[model samples]
Target: MPRSAREPGRATVQVTNHRLARLPDVQSQEVAPRTTPGSGPVVDVEQAEAALVEHYPRLVRLAYLVLPPGLGRTRRVLTAHALVQRALPRRRASASVIPAQAAGGTDGGGEDPGYSLLRLQVLRTALEAGRPPKRTAWPRRSQLPPLFPQVWGLKLFPRSGGAEELALDQQLSALSGPARAAYVLRGLERLPEDHVRKVLSAAGVTRPTAALREASRVPRQDALLESPEFDPCSLQARPTDLMRRRQHTKAALAAAGAAVVCGVLLAVPSGGWGPDGAAAPGYAQNPAARAALDPAKVTKVPPTAWRTSARTDFSVWPARGGLTGDTALLRRALAVWSRPGGSVQVSATPGTPSGAPAGPPQLLYAGRVDAARVVIFYDGLRLARYAEPARGTDGAALDFARVDAATGAEAEAVVLGRADGNVRYLTAPWVTKAAERDLLEPSAEAVDLGLQDGVTAPLAGPAEATGSCSSWNVLQLTEGSGIRLLTDLGELTPAHLTVGRPGAPGEASEPEALRTWSPFACSLAAVRSQGVRSVNAWEFARQTLPDGSGSAAWVCTRADTWRGDGPRVLAQFQTPGGRYGAVAAKAEGVTACGTKDPHVLAGVLWKSAEGRWYLLAAGSSDTGSIRATGGVTGSADGNLLAVRAAQGAQAGLKGTLEDGRTISGLR
Candidate 1:
C-alpha cells in the first residue's frame, strides 16, 4: 500500500472587512469566583465581541456542519448563534467553561482564543443537539447530517471498501459523544492532537482515534500514520466513573458492526450502510462505476437556473408565488421579457398547475400549503416562485422552482450566498414534497438526504424605499425567463430575466443557495428516504507541491467571500488498483418527483476484479422516497456512481464555489 498523496496547491487569499457598525454592548458585570484555575479575568465583553466579529461567520458555518441539515439552514444558523451566545463567557458559568479547557485555560492562556471559542461553541452545540429532546426518539446515525467534507481528509479516494472517506463519517456518527468531540476538535478543527485527547478524556473516550482508526482499518498507510506530533493534554479530572459505566454496557453493537466507546451506539447495521435504514449487503463492494461512464455520454449541464423553457400558456399562478404579490406585477414581469420577436402575456391564475386537483400540497410550501407564492406553467408542467421568511424583520430567502419539460417533474434549484453577498448554486433537484409526506425532516421511509453548503445570509431589500412597501418582498419567476423582485403589488424592478442564473454573486442579492439548499435537502431526503444513492466528494486547500503545480484554488469556492488560491474541489474515486477524479451526482440534475430513476446511482467509485477504477455518474430519473422494509430494499437501484472513469475527471475550474462543491457528486 502507498501513503495517500495529499499535495495541496497554492490557494489565493480573499480579504474582506465587515464594518460592525454596531456591536453588542460590552456592559460591565459582576463575576462569581471560580474553584479551578479555569477562572480568568472577567470575559472582556469587548474582546469577546471582537471574537464574534472575527470568528462569528466561521462559527455559523461550523454550526451548519455540526448540526442537522433537517433543521433547515436558517434555524441552524440561529441555533448556532444561540449556542455561541449561551456559551459566551459573559456570565460566571459561561466564563468558567470558557477558561476550563479553552486553548490554554489551565496554564492561564490559550494558543487560539477565537478558535478555542469556536471549538467549544460547536462541541456544546453538537452535544446539546445530539441529546434527544425530552423523550424524543433517539436520532439514528443515518439521520445525522453528514459531517463537513473537510473531516474526511479524502481527496482522490484514499482506498476502497469504505476505509478512505465514506467510512470515516459513518463511523464518527456512531461514536460516543465524547469521541465525536475529540474527532471534531482534533481533525476537523485541526486542533493539537494532545488537546483533542484531553477533551476526549472529559467525554470518556479512552482512545481518541479508536473509531476513526477502526473505521479505517487498513494497511500501514492509515489516518493514524498521517500525523504523529500530537500528545493528549493533561486533564485535572478524568472520567473514570463514566468509562466504568460504559464497560458495563454491551460490548458488541448487534445492530451496527462498530466498536462503541463508553456505550456509544451506532445508527447503522452490521452489514454495509445505505440510505434510509436498510442494510447495504454490498457495503464492502465497489462497482468501479467510474470506468463504465464515458465522458462523451456525460451531459454538459449547468447546476442552477431561474428560467423555464417549458412554456406556461396559463394566465393564472398559485402572493406566496412572486415578487409583487399582485396580479398587475405579472403583466410587468411579462413585459420585461417581451422582446422584438417574442411576446410575453401571462396573468395571475387562481388555481394550481392545469387544475391538478389543488386540494392541498402534500408538504406545506412555507408551513401553509394553501399557497402564497406565484406559479406559472402549462399542462402538467409547473414553476413555483415565492419568498421565504427572513431572519428577524429582515427577509433574506427566495425560492425558485420549475418543472422538467421532458419528465414533467418539478424541482427547485439550490443557491448558497457568499460572504460578498454573491450567490453560489448548490445541488439542483431539491424536493418540496413526495406524495403525502414531507422529507425535509427526519423520515424513516425517506432517504434522509443531507447537504452542507456552508454559508447563509438574510434576504435583500430595495436600495431606496419603494413607496414604503412592506419590509419583506416576494419574488417571481416566468417560464423561459429569470427571477424578478415584486417590490410593489404591481411592480417589478431591474427586470433582468435569466435563462439559468441566480442574479449576481455579491451583496444586495438573494442568498439563493441558502434558500435552495433547504428545499433541495428535502428533495434529497425524500429521494433517499427509501435510499437510492450516496457517494464520495472531496475539497483541497492551498499548498505548493514539490512538483510545479502552483495554480490558484478558488474554482470550487467563493473568491470574494471565501476565496482561496486553490481551495477548489475535484470529485473522484478509488479502485483496487488506483484512483481517479470526477464530479458529484447532484450536479447532473434530477427531478423532484415521479419514478424518474428507479435505480438512480451516480458518482459511486468502486473496484474491479482487475483492479481498475470506474467512474459513475447519475443516470436520468426522479422519484420520491419509497419506504423500504424487511422484505425488500432499493439500495440496489443504482443512482450511485461506479462507472465512467478516464474521461470523467472533473474539469478543474477557477471561481467562487457553492454548496454544490460539498454536495455529493453523481447522485
Candidate 2:
C-alpha cells in the first residue's frame, strides 16, 4: 500500500545548496526545482519504482546498516530487503519531499528525487524495526518480521570484514537507532552535516541534532562503510540443520498415517480414536542436542570445480583423500567433532568459535596421514580438523581455526600431520611445486619436496624444534602464477609469510625479501598456534651507529590472524655484526604496525663497543618527529633517535606522524 499525495508540479520552492550537494547523480538542469520544508520533486509511482529498481542494492545496504543488530544477521538481511521493496508509493502520483543533492555525494555519485523518497522511506522503517513493542499499542507493520521474502532451509548473511570494520560495527551497535542512521548517512551517503540533519528530520527522527552529535563520537572510517561486511546484497549462504529437517520429515509422515487411521475408525462406528488422559507430556527435541551424524548429508565439492571458479578462497577447495567415501569414518569424525570425549584433546585458535557445525560441512580431506586418520571440514567460516588413531577413536583431537575469506595463497596448504621431527602437508590441487627453505639462512637454496597426489613429502617442522632456535624452516608452494611461503605454527594450518611493507607485501622467494626475513625468522614462535593467516616483515628504518661502529636496521614484523582480531606486532633492532635481531618492543591486539596503521615507534638499550650505553629509538619512515619522555628525555627531527643513557634506563616514546596524528611506541 502506498501513501496518497497531491498531483505533480504543485510545489515551487528552491532547496539550499547544502541540500543540493547531497546527491551525487543530480544533473545541472536549465531550471532548478523548488521545495518547501518537507517537499521536493514530484515522484509518480512509475518514477519511484524505477528508482528503487536502479538502486535496490544500495537501499538494502543502507537499511541493513541502520537496522538494529539484535535482530540477528539472517533476519536483518530479510527485513532490509522487505523494507526496501515496500518503499514504493502506492498511489499513481506522490510528491517526494526529499530533494536530490549534488553529484559529489557519498553514494558513489547518483541522484534522483524518487531515490531520495525511497531512501527516506527505508530509513524510517529501519528505525522503526529497532524499537521495542509497547503494551498498549499494536506493533507497526515495519516492526514485525515480513512473511514474504523468506529463505527456506538456508541462512544468508554478509561476509565478514577486517578488524576496523568489525570495531566500527560494534561501535554502531552501541548507539541509538537515530544515531546509527546519522552515522550511516554521514559516512555512506557522504552528506554534509546540515544535509544529514535535514535528511534525518525528513525521515522522522525527532532529535536529529542530538543524533548527529552522538554519531560524531565514532572514528571517521568512511572507507570501511563500503566494505562487504555491511552489504547484505552480497551474501554468503549456508544450509540450516539437516538432522532436524530429516526428523521433521519423519514426523510429518507419522502424522499422515495417524490421520488415515482416524478416518477409518470414524467410518466404522466409533467417532474417532479414544483420547488418552494418561499420555505423557509432549515436547520437541532441541536442535542443539541432536547430533549431526548423517554421513550422506556431508557436503562434498567436485574435483575440478576450482579450475573455473571465480573465487580463489577455501570455498573452492575440492574434497580430497581416500576415505571420503567411507560413511563409518565420516560419521565418527562428525560425531566426535560435535561431542568430543574427555580424552579428546580440543584446541581452538583465539576468537574462533568451538561450537558444533551448523549443518553438513564441506569435506576438504578425509584420509590416513602417518599413523592417524585426519578429517578436515570447512563450514563457510572456520576449518575443523578431526584426528584419531587408525585403529580406534580413542585419544581423538579436534582443532578449529578461522579461515573466512582466505585467498588462494593463504589457503594454499594445511599441515596434515606431524610425526617425530617431521611434518606432512596437504597442498591445494592448483599447486605445481613444493619446497622447504631455511629462513635463517637467506643465501641457502630451497630443497624441493616432492608432491604425491596433492600431498607433500614430510619435512622437518619448526613447531617440533626446541632448545636454542638456530634454524627456521618454511614451506614454499608454487601455486599457478606466484609463489607463497607458509610456516608451521604448531597448528593444523600454517601461517603465510610475506615481506616488504604492510600494504605492498611480496613473496619471500626474492633475495632481498629472504634477507629481510633472516634476522627475525625466530620471531614466528611468538605467534604460533594463534591462527595466524599471514606475517609481514618490513625494514622501516636504518640508522648509523653514534659510536662509529656500523649501521643498524630497524624492522617491524606484524602477524595477522584469520580471526581479524588480536594481531601481533613486534619492533626489532638488528646490529650490523649480530647474527639475530633483538626485540626492541612488542604489543598484542594493536594495529600499530599493521596495514591500516603502518607507523610504529620503538626503543632499545644498546651497549657500544667502547663500553658506553645508549638509548636507541626509531619510528617508521612516516614519523615527523620522535620524543622520549618519562625516565629518559630526548627528541629527534626524523625517524631515528639515539641518546646517551644509563644501562637500566626506561622511557616512554611518542611519535608524530607527518599527517599530524600522534602515535605511541609499542611495548
lDDT of 1 by residue, 490-516 (tens): 111111111111122221113432221
lDDT of 1 at 353: 24
Clash totals in order: 98, 14
Tens-digit lDDT track of model 2 for 1-667: 0001112222111111101111111111111112223446556678889888888988999999999999999999999999999989875333444455545764532667778888889999999999998999999998998876999889999999999988999999999999999999888887778888888987789999999999999987878988999999999999999999899989999999999998666545323222111111121134433334456777788989889998887787888998999887887677666666677788888788887787778889999899999989988888888888888677788888888888878888877888777989888879999999999888998999999878899988763222236688999898777888889988777888888888998888789999998878877887877878889999999988776867888888999988788889877777765555666667788887787878888776555666565667788898999887765678999888888866455566788989999987775
Which candidate leads the pack in lDDT? 2
**What lDDT is obtained when candidate 2 is compared to the true structure?**
0.77
Cα TM-score per model: 0.21, 0.56
* Lowest lDDT block of 10, candidate 2: 11-20
**What range of 10 consecutive residues in model 1 has the weakest lDDT sum?**
554-563
